[model samples]
Target: MNGTIHNRDKFLNQIASRLNRPRISSKIQKPKWKYQPQHEVYKDATQDELLAVLEEHCKKIHTDIFTTDLQGLPAVVNDVVANCGGGPVVTWKDERFSEWGLDSVMKKEWPSQQIDVFEWDHTLGEENIDKAENANVGITISEITLAESGTVVLFSDKDKGRTVSFLPKASIMLIPKSTLVPRMTQAAVKMREVYQKTGHVASCINFITGPSNSADIELNLVVGVHGPIKATYIVVNDL
Candidate 1:
């Protein structure tokens, strides 16, 4: 115990001596102001125009398009699959979605359980991930995300499971208009608001930009390396 105390004292004295020995004077550092400037005033087009923009962008990116009327999502999902291709495995967990009439919307030839809706608990160890990865289509509802950069923010809570977005062939996300922020900085501000109010931190937070892509080997851009090959973002205007 005596030797340990002496070692601690020696460390403290060394730190103090180093602090006291700094004698060189330097000019005060000027703050870096606005490295990247943001727009002074924000302007958005009409709802129809915005939807048109989204559709055009999605088409250019070769993403299967879908929209949620917020009245009945299960029905909308049916059209989304039919538009993409028949026989897609629609995986959803929300009870409301299940109740929104999925069984009836599916085609007769498709198996009864092809559209599998399971109630998932995040506590379940890696099982949901396996299910999502095997699925052809995965659906999720985001709390909010930035529309401009096409970024989807998953809060990584019990309801918004991580695998829902990450481990699927294709992702279909439903984001309410009330939660849509324009830019990345706004996303941080919204997160801060939640932190200040709830005092609750998440287990994980993911910011997904488009589909999983990589250019590791031969410097050639490759898609679907880490996650889904295709992603569809459905911005629900009505919250």
Candidate 2:
């Protein structure tokens, strides 16, 4: 009878506690990086295979290309855009982009005339986002990464707003091949340290593997339903 009464008291206490639970949530800052379950370092993969893997994982074929060096930018962009039927490519204003000789590539290539290239300025306001989404391709250069999960990090200060990377149907990210890291943990540590020293949290740190995708409906996988349909990265070493 004593044991039964003890159990009854414990249940009553739990019920009372639940009834008087606090209304406000704590303001604790969680870890900056979200750990993806399948986050593992892909090894011994060729560039072609890497591209193939990204495409396979995202379930969408992308003609968009990413390159870090200001030099190979033209070739990669031309190759990817031409493959995608030479549609308009929207890019932000940057000296590196100009150094890539994008103008020459545009003028010399037969497809350039068919494609419209727009340079974005901050003055465009929110409406530019809609224009980027409607365009055939969106291209931007990345800072660099250290080649573990094939992750690319974007800082919001680059003027290529976070939306520029995510909102488009196809995103082309160019990173210096040297930026690849071997693990997600290393990336997280670096990010944390940076925040500690700077005292300013990175406005955005987007880790885009390929394209945005989901498989939630009756286990039926779908691609490009919610976000971009495709993503491509050109690990440029020449820059």
Best by TM-score: 1
Model 1 residue 238 lDDT score:
71
Model 1: clashing residue pairs? none
What is candidate 1's TM-score against the reference?
A: 0.69
Off by over 4 Å in 2: 1-71, 106-112, 144-146, 193-201
Query: What's the lDDT for candidate 1?
Result: 0.64
Candidate 1: residue 34 Cα off by (Å):
7.1
Prediction 2 global C-alpha lDDT = 0.63
Candidate 2: tens digits of C-alpha lDDT, residues 156-192 = 6545656666666677777655455445665777788
What are the per-residue Cα lDDT tens digits for candidate 1 across 85-177? 543453445654435444455433245546554445567657776766676767776665655556678777666578777676777777666
- The weakest ten consecutive residues by lDDT in model 1 span 36-45
In order, candidate lDDTs are 0.64, 0.63
